[model samples]
Target: MIVFFHHLTLATTTTNPSYLTPSTARCNSTAVTSCTTTTSIIARCQSYEVSWNNHCYYLDGLGGNCTTGYSLATNAVLGCIATQFASKTYRSTISNNCCVWTADTYECYGFNNNCNTAGPFSAGPVWSGAGCLSVQQRYSAQLTFCGSN
Candidate 1:
């Protein structure tokens, strides 16, 4: 199992209102093709993968120019992980903090203050695909975040 531990610099103006909130879903995957049965299960597995990939992308500052900065964050993180580990299992431990600017136009970044705050958090280990012959390997992905108190 591969492991990654680091802090993400996520800062934006108040007008942007960016929060370091975790994804609602614990696990996500992509759609599976060429499957005749157990489509639902396959879909779930795919969703988990997709969810984790997106999370990685956003954290790496590749989420693109979105109002909430979600898109950029997801893309960056995903791209970084994929580039390094083409085909390998890895776990990530993320340090979560809410940083925001004082004004909409001005940039003043800080964490866990009146201007910035934290949100609900959750983390778990992700198992490789199940019931899908295409992905019959034992891999695990664990993600944890340090919430701002």
Candidate 2:
């Protein structure tokens, strides 16, 4: 039987990035490498996790979707913009932290401390990239809230 493989990396502009999954079936403890199947990759991602840029990310704050995670989430200090993560859910286990944007990188950076605001929603998992980063590194790289649909 010929088994077709699904490539997880979807072609997307930074302005509208799509959720990615493991491209390979067998992945090392570090990166996804050559493999002959795809089931392993799919299993790698958790229920609350989504794959992107060849790695697993937790579902955090979301942009666009015509809805906000919390009341003050739209504040300028949060740097919530209708950019890459717009219309899509941002992955993180942290709180009202900003998704720091650099020249070529945009990772959710903050702590587990919730913002001084209140709403029907709550912060998502306090993840550190689901094995993507060390626990100690989580201090600089935090997660986002899991907003409602």
How would you encode candidate 1's per-residue C-alpha lDDT over 80-149 as one tens digit per residue? 2222222222122222222211112211222222111122222211122112112211112112111111
**How would you encode candidate 2's per-residue C-alpha lDDT over 3-52 as one tens digit per residue?**
99987987876542212211222212343223222234432544444333
C-alpha lDDT (0 to 100) for residue 3 of candidate 1: 96
**Where is model 2 more than 4 Å wrong at Cα?**
1-41, 52-55, 59-94, 100-149
Error of 1 at 142 (Å): 7.7
- Candidate 1 structure lDDT: 0.22
Please tell me which predicted candidate would have the highest TM-score against the true structure: 2
lDDT of 1 at 25: 27
